[model samples]
Target: MSTDAKTFLLTGGRAPCTLELARLLYHAGHRVIVAESLRHHLCRFSRAVARNVHVPPPRQDPDGFLSSLAEIVNQEKVNVLIPTCEEVFTLARGSGRFPDHCRVWVEPIERLTPLHNKWTFIQEAGELGLQTPMTWMAASHSKLTEILRNINGKFPIILKPVYSRFAAEVYLLRHPAQPCPALSVSPEKPWIVQEWIDGRQICTYSLAFEGKLIAHCAYRTTFTAGKGSSILFTPIEHPQLLKHVEEWMASKKYTGQFSFDWIETAEGKLYPIECNPRATSGIHCFGESDRLDQAFARPETASLILPQAGVQRMLSLAMWSYGLFSVRSFSQWRNWIKSLLAAQDVVFRWRDPLPFICQFLLLIYFWKQSRRHQISMLEASTYDIEWNGEY
Candidate 1:
């Protein structure tokens, strides 16, 4: 083992972002162990991972998940434990269970999970000195109906569950008179109605230590799986934008991975939509380099790591399957070609290629899960790990 290298246990090995992160850490001379709920995942076949541990799904069995994680930390002598998915919430809730030697890169549930809540995040972001979209929380059917009546169709509105991933439950209201869909709106599963902004979607993925930023990357999604969840990340550089977002996060004294979704209007004003306080595809915008690794491993001495210029990343499989269908016009086709030419597949590496080959198996896994659960394939992907205010 390298003298400077540390053993890292990263959760959510099933996610492409986690696989890419493991590659970055491994390339930097650190040992990476992946803990996932699924029997098969992308990292299971990757050369970057040193070990793969199957643990109970964090969303389904929080106690069992924590016990397995604690055992892994003590036995493997993990130096750092990073949660790369919604599992972050469960781990954050049970953070004290781990032994003393391991440093878990997550905030406490109280400080962290609030950011995951759409309703609270907007209010909190405003207090923290960031522009946020106008949002209203509706905890009951009566409240939701009243909020819709108040909107009066002045402009478009979007209703989404306060705790949802990938815009899976998003509903767009084009007119105020349209009857709202029947939804479970209660204290336990509240919804937020946000004023729709016409602008470019600018998303960020950042790693912070204490109140300071270690690495930051802002991206405008080029291609997406559906309405949300970008498959291609086009890194953009705007000093002023990055500065404001970084200062906003620094004000929270935030630690761990803090990511955001923002709407940048034609006038260049940014309105933050929600916060994910966990890893996102923005990780793909970065290369397998030591800067990000050093930032996570030794944040004190590490300088801010930014995305490499002119670099774009995509899920090549999605480009063919989902992106191809997205093209409807000649201009769209041209842009699609440009994006395809400019970006590299996030998974495929010429030297280390087994993981890329095995990605098909992971797809099959999701297919089986979707069929068994009678849900959308995208929902099935994170069904086991996604969190929604379960205590």
Candidate 2:
């Protein structure tokens, strides 16, 4: 389907992935409107966006946030609202506020809430016969102790909030040395404790139409920490991994774009880690496959071949090397020097430079501000700066 007549609204446009997605949509002939909360960054980085609207950050006034979004949808006649972050939750819950003329792509709240909860996800996936890590949900000291006693094996278990918007309160428990660190106090809220799987981190990005997988690509994480999606290396299709993904989607009747993180154990068995119902950082790897058009299309399509192993490996290495040089432990001056060199490296090497350049400048600004205690890591993660249509 041609996107010529379509107007797309991208939420969380400040995210590097969202910016790249907007650029792709624009190149494909869709008029793009970027909805962001930070005016300064948006004004500087989002010049290519056909329109920009500054809304309250999602963390504050989530209920009132949709009013501004609805205004944009009305003005632009947006056909599709693609959310790139937790901001999606506000839009999804406020879907009723959207004009009847517009279509918002999101999973139903029933499915979405369950999927977002790690404990619920594990239970549901297990019931569906999908391979998932052993999981327990605990909300109090008694429950936590029970879970600890039950696990006979490892030391470093994983503790995560059942309904975390982002990767907040995620801990790697090395042992029962202490309590689970009270992720939340409310008795109504529970966290998931699961056996940590040791293996290679692999991911699949796919579009499913009516429970049928149309397009798919898989990649391996080259660098990742508590914060997600640092870098990844694309790989050719793995039939086994594809099989598991197809089964899970079919069972759940999932539609739209979804990504799954899996671990390949020593026995060569693939165990599901977590599932993200929206577009993920691994979507960048799809560029290697050339199947990105299928993702843009409404319905499912074909599997695209990614870059050869050599190219993906090289790119992964380049990014890692750059990270090492650019990210220092304590030497602030050296970090800045290395970052400048890294920026030059990326500029000369990136296929598309404009978005990368915008992102680079924003990074430098935030890095400087971070050192001054202007923005915490959590705040930085939610940045939504606006650039006033200036390139």
Best by TM-score: 1
Deviating ranges (above 4 Å) for candidate 1: none
Most accurate candidate by lDDT: 1
Q: Evaluate residue 350 in candidate 1 and report its C-alpha lDDT on the 0 to 100 scale.
A: 86
Lowest-lDDT window of 10 residues in candidate 1?
A: 288-297
lDDT of each: 0.89, 0.64
**lDDT for position 193 in model 2:** 84
CA displacement after TM-score superposition, residue 76 of candidate 2 (Å): 1.2
By summed lDDT, the worst window of 10 consecutive residues in model 2 runs over 382-391
What is candidate 2's lDDT per residue for 1-391, written digit by digit as tens? Answer: 2634478888876665676566566666677788877654422354447887788876566656788888889988888887776666566567788887776766665666666567777777788776778788888868877778878576679887666534556788887775666556335667778888889878787767668777677877644433555443445568898888788888888866677778898898888877777776655544423535435545544443343443232223335444455454567446444433432231222445465456556666666656676655444655432111111
